[model samples]
Target: MKNSLKLVLAVVLCVFLAGVAGFADEYILGIGFTIFMYIALAQSWVVLSGLTGYISLGHVVFFGSGAYVFILIWGLVPVWLGVFCSGIVVGLVSLIVGYPVLRVRGPYFVILSFGLAELVKNLVLINEARMYVSMRPVFGAPALYQLYTAMLLLAIIATGLTYWIRRSRFGAGLRSIREDEEAAETIGVPVAKLKLLAFAISGVIPAMVGAIFIMRSGIFQSGDAFTPIVSFTMVTMAIIGGSDDAPGPFLGVVFLVLLQELLWVNWPEVYMIILGILLLGFVLFIPNGIYGWLSEKYFGNKKNVT
Candidate 1:
């Protein structure tokens, strides 16, 4: 489909979903919230990893760190303010660390990203132990509808950011760097600057996503907060959605999350097995993912993000 039509559909869908949040039962609302949360996370990943071809295997570090930051100051401030602060803190830290980390390329950078997340997780774990802090149930979180609304807003922000960036000169430069860093730099692209900026941009929303997610769960554990599966799911959604443009992550997240929900309900014993099969099927048959495949079928290699 054309970008214009896709944008229209997205806006309509967002409006419809927003309208439903007010009347949907708690279970359905929770599902919608999870979907929006993943949408935000996936689009945020696309800002850096998808556009720049710098696949991040440890994106959950920001998520977990954001959760930790918010948990530490949970009752000390307004919840929304705490979520905002988490994003700000994570963004700044990523900017500082991204400078040196962005120097690596290829598989090495991937390994570094994964290792960095693990290191942060262990440090948090050790710190928690030292403080003798046991996991405590969260109390007095904001209303469910309030969190759902906030998360929906975040999803919109992340989706719009990716969409805008994908067609802008900056996004073009990032894609160029993705294709060939040395060649992009030879042509005057500020490779380091764009990568760092994208890296920082990618970190912010997920941090907020993590903060809100913890509030939803009403308890925090370092292990669950920093789990690698979060990273895996984000990457998988982007890949499955064909992170070539604005609508891809939304499609990917909805499909996977809904599929998982159904499978878990009916085939709990083999839900993961079915998911693995689906992932593998996408990898083998629909390599470009659902959006990419659709574009190819309808546009015949005609679609371009720019």
Candidate 2:
């Protein structure tokens, strides 16, 4: 009952933010959109990496694929339909990729995931060059509003799904796999299937968000779509906020987005350096992240209170 109320309040808050964006200055709306976008992306990353303890350096593969797929199909269908289809396609891709890749554990899995993303990016670049693929920049108030609302919805869905998984039997299985994969399997956790399912679920939202984001931006490029920086940013957000907790990624996104905006405005040249220092400090001192630290300090155990 408490969780349900929290979810309801969150939804109401997002809707209220949307309503405010409708009347706010374009700059403010843009900031809101960026924040929501990162929240969705970070949460999606957390779904698999946080829950299953598989760090994927190439999760941007789905994001880029969705953006490209949306561009490919947008002209033939409604924009909304195109975005949905893009997510389905990306989720299917994750299932196929996860089957073989999930067999490898630890750093090898992370490296393979990164390789796959690079491969996808190269393929996209080659295709764009060969076919002269290009998109005209989209603009206007209506497009912005649509993008903002879609992003907000994606964030909400991702957060709700994380909350559900954290409390479900399936979530417990994933947590076990994270702690000890072989032990999980020995205990009949069906590690392989659960990991793949989690991976697929993690893929879908980011893909949908990518499609919506590209549509809003009005232009798409292979480089931007497949950038490893995005994947890194999501991972950083999840880690910095507390990857073990459902609310960690969201909190991390909120802090990072605001920090980024401030840095970009005042110290763009040194922002990356500052970010690196902060990340290093977190790794050395608060490895479990802010959420984990706070939970330990106040509640003793996040699972109990959450």
Best by lDDT: 1
Q: State each model's C-alpha RMSD to the native.
A: 1.6, 2.0
| Per-residue lDDT of candidate 2, residues 1-306 (tens digit) | 386798798878977987875777778778888888888888888879998989999989889999888877867887788889999999998899889988999999999999989999999898888887654353431467667878888888888788788889998899899889999999899898999999999999889888888876778888898899989999999889988767889888899989999999999999999999999999999888888888888778753344
- Please give the lDDT score for candidate 1: 0.90
Q: Candidate 1 lDDT, tens digit per residue, 1-306?
A: 686898798889889988887888999889989999999999999999989989899999989989998898889988889999999999999999999999999899899999989999999999999999767467999888888989999999999999899989999999999899999999999999999999999999999999999989999899999999999999999888877776889899999999989988898999988878888888898877888888889877734633
The residue pairs in collision within model 2 are: 138-218
Q: Model 1: number of clashes?
A: 0
Q: How good is model 2 by TM-score?
A: 0.94
| Deviating ranges (above 4 Å) for candidate 1 | 1-8, 302-306
